[model samples]
Target: MIPPVSAPDFLVKAGWPGAAIVPLAGDASFRRYFRVLDGGRRAVLMDAPPPHEDPRPFIAIAEHLVADGFAAPRILARDLDEGLVLIEDFGDDRLKEHVDAQPDNEMTVYSRAIDLLVDLHKLPAADLPPYDRAVYRREVGLVTEWYCPAIGLAVDEDAYNCAWDSVLPIVEQSASPIVTVLRDYHAENIMLIDQPEAYGLGLLDFQDALAGHPAYDLVSLLQDARRDVPPEIEAAMLARYKALASPPADFDAAYAVLGAQRNAKIIGIFTRLWKRDGKPRYLAYLPRMWGLLERDLAHPALAPVAEWFATNIPADKRHQALQEFALA
Candidate 1:
């Protein structure tokens, strides 16, 4: 990521000149977040300093989420020119932290999350960029671009894409009315709210939401790159979601295809984080991600991708790659 250009003086410029600001955790993007305080009021200050980051997409998506009766932070103020926005503060009870503290409640927690998705899927996807085949192909191409070289495998971009080309259409043909895909909808980005009427979940990091296949966010949630979701919990939640929502004609196959695509893309992304950005912590997720990919590959619809992995990356090589990159 490029260095942040300058601190936005927007809050000071707009009345609360002495608002207390404290740094919060950031993700892979160029955007930074800060907790802001003024008198008794609290809000989140998003520092999305541009030429590298944009705030419009975030504001648009947050509006959509709120309009749909979901728990997205309320935008209090904005200065798009400076890439700054002050949003409501949904205080600390991230789903991941809650799950960590009470593992037994995992099923209940996931079910509630699934309920939110079921409601969201009923509505029309917002006017946003489509997560179409071209996008899927480009993203999945990450595995070939970064991962293969990291593990000392030969590069053959055309052949790799050819393999995915055969499989990706399965997703395109099966998807129905698209829904808002909060592309990063997972445990880390979901905050558990305490208020009874507040939807029980707070959405975050959704600037990249797109009109995408419904199964895409499901895959993101179940096949989380950052955590080891229990096999039983994943299976149960998937079943629960399918039972509640009227899914597409080829829902199972579409889910598998998107899961495989997401996992493959993540492998390359984690490798890039290590090699290009000096972030090795992401490398530790590689082994788990590999395991998830292998499971997704077992789906019959993923035959071509599975075959590609089998021929180019044998089990021994796969294990070797994991051992080489994963944390001890």
Candidate 2:
């Protein structure tokens, strides 16, 4: 996902007087980035599409995290009206890429990262918006409207309705106390700052942060989109998170329901990405997500959900639909 040299070129040619520039890689999003190497100095350039990708919220969140003790990339300069941002270069060591490539050092790496999430959840989020039933329904309903229609399936109207009906209440009731929820607290969004004193992770892509269930991030991390996290590793992480986080009342039940709801919404979204955006790589993550979906459904609290999925989403149909989307 490395962008072309255009951005770096623009910065070097038109940026600060006598500044140097170098293009760096970017991830899959509406955003693009470049490295600014200005006469032995360094900075990163962010190119968000003007009128489409706003940078104000990103600016706000990045500053907030920095003030809150997280090593987010520091903003050097900005042009909100033009949608450009110059930030400190945090290097190319993405947390997901680093851990996946170094299997032997995986646990040590994730343990450290998990601790960061624990701290984030412990912080109060009284001001954040609620991730209520409406939000859950909207996310899941996207499947019925966007994904199902794109795939040419009639979107088993009855099934889509019943599926969410059976699942949302379970998710809502078991929801844990709210916290500063970084919506995409998954691996890809975290950059491992390869430094000495601040070996802590650098948070990125957090403009979507809100206040909601704490376990949501843990699931997002363990059930990552780009890699296969081993069951043993996932178990180890879950146990560690539970031990560190003393959940209120019936935490176990709430966590399970949340996981199921999360996985289901993810599956639909991945499918939608394939059909709607023509991004087929997302389909590869489906097989893994489906298995996780089944496991989460195994929780006794989600029995009705399991039954609904079993009756409505046939094994052959799900498999065939996924393949069609991938091919499409």
The TM-score leader among the candidates is 1
Task: Indicate which candidate wins on lDDT.
Answer: 1
Pairs that collide in candidate 2 are 20-38
lDDT of 2 by residue, 229-308 (tens): 88888888878887887766666666677777777787778777766666777777777777777788898877876787
TM-score of each: 0.93, 0.86
Q: What is the alpha-carbon lDDT for the whole of candidate 2?
A: 0.72
Model 2 worst lDDT window (10 residues): 1-10
lDDT of 1 by residue, 249-270 (tens): 6999999999999999898888
Q: Residue 139 deviation, candidate 2, in Å?
A: 0.9
Q: How far is candidate 2 from the true structure (C-alpha RMSD, Å)?
A: 3.1
Cα error, candidate 2, residue 314 (Å): 0.9
The root-mean-square deviation over C-alpha atoms between each candidate and the true structure, in angstroms, is 2.4, 3.1
lDDT measured at residue 236 in model 1 versus the true structure, 0 to 100: 94
- Write down the worst ten-residue block by lDDT for model 1: 1-10
